[model samples]
Target: MLKKLLFLFVLAVLCLTFIPQLTKPSSTLVTVFKLTENPAVIVKGAQGSALTVNISFGEKEVEELLGQLTKPYPLLFVDSDWASRFPHLAEEIKKRSVPVALLGVQGQSYETDLNLFAEQLSQFEKIFAARPLWFRTADEEFPSSLLQQLQKAEINALGSTVQWKEGKLPKASKGEIISVSYHSGGRPKISDVKRLMESRTYQSVEDLLFRPTVKTKKIPQ
Candidate 1:
């Protein structure tokens, strides 16, 4: 009986030491998607001439833009900096089922500013009930170290091919990503956005990136 009890205690100690390690998440580098002359990231199954729009601005501007857009809305990059200040916007985004990505606070040093980052992420998840899969910097520029950190966190980094300007609707190409910001000057006019929509179909960033492509079968020629 003494021998059996000692064996059981050893087994329990082994399980306690190894179980948490087995369950811990892996820290691997994830893919970073960005625009380049020779693009490193490609949308594998994209269809047609679809584009994605990412908007980073104030809550009022976002609300106004959301009201103006129809089906296939733009992806909003909510900054942790201002998310707490706009509870109504968060509720509205949740109510509307809008897609979102994390927009890092402008001029943030991710290495040293982790506390703010964590707080913002916590607040965002509290309101949205989930974590975002995508992330981008407010200035559209991401540091290499930050990219690695984001990858370890399992969040993909996204970059824009086109930066929409005030009073001008930049022509977007197929598979291109457009970023609209109030920080550039002011909120983009609804008319410009409408015109862009009329020009071509705009898809959510998630859809454009991950949606499976539908291939047409060629009838016997």
Candidate 2:
């Protein structure tokens, strides 16, 4: 009798714990979508031209990802000094026809110093058998001086986040080469903008290449 009573008490405690979750207010149960301050963007100089995308993954995942895609996507790879650990990543990127860039070469002192951008590019070329045409970062914030330095390095195209101040574009290098911005979400979901994706299905790469800056609306936290 004591064992059965103890079992009943434990069952009641379990029910109390789970019942609250099941009986949550309907308002709290609604699906809410949060709009990020910075939306993903793609920059293509011309309508019919290729757009660039970025990935921060190792060789095996990159290879498997590329194998599954039927269409051509211009991938942007950022190589760092520590990339020596993944010696085969460069070759994997080259075979996939992705563009390579070097990170930690700009303002972020926590990473590499600004001086190593060119050096890393050179190192990447030797290692990957392809040259990177642009200099960029995961967080696309470049001071004016760094912009000039990158331009001087012959990195005509720049990949960065699309930022605006007080309804106006920031006074960065305006007439320079192509600048690209992508969804800040490390793992971007194409389904979030399914309607736009479907409308531009025929031009998937070109459509997806443009930045997905959306209007900011208040959403539940």
Among these predicted structures, which one has the highest TM-score? 1
TM-scores for all candidates: the values are 0.66, 0.47
Query: Each model's RMSD to truth, in Å?
Result: 10.4, 21.7
Q: Candidate 1 — worst ten consecutive residues by lDDT sum?
A: 212-221
Candidate 2 residue-wise lDDT, 126-204, digit = tens: 7766555445554554544455465555443344323221122233332212223232233333332222223222233
Candidate 1 backbone overlaps, count:
0
Clashing pairs in 2: 40-182, 40-183, 40-212, 41-181, 41-211, 42-209, 42-210, 42-211
Which residue pairs show backbone clashes in model 1?
A: none
Model 1: how far is 217 from its true place, Å? 37
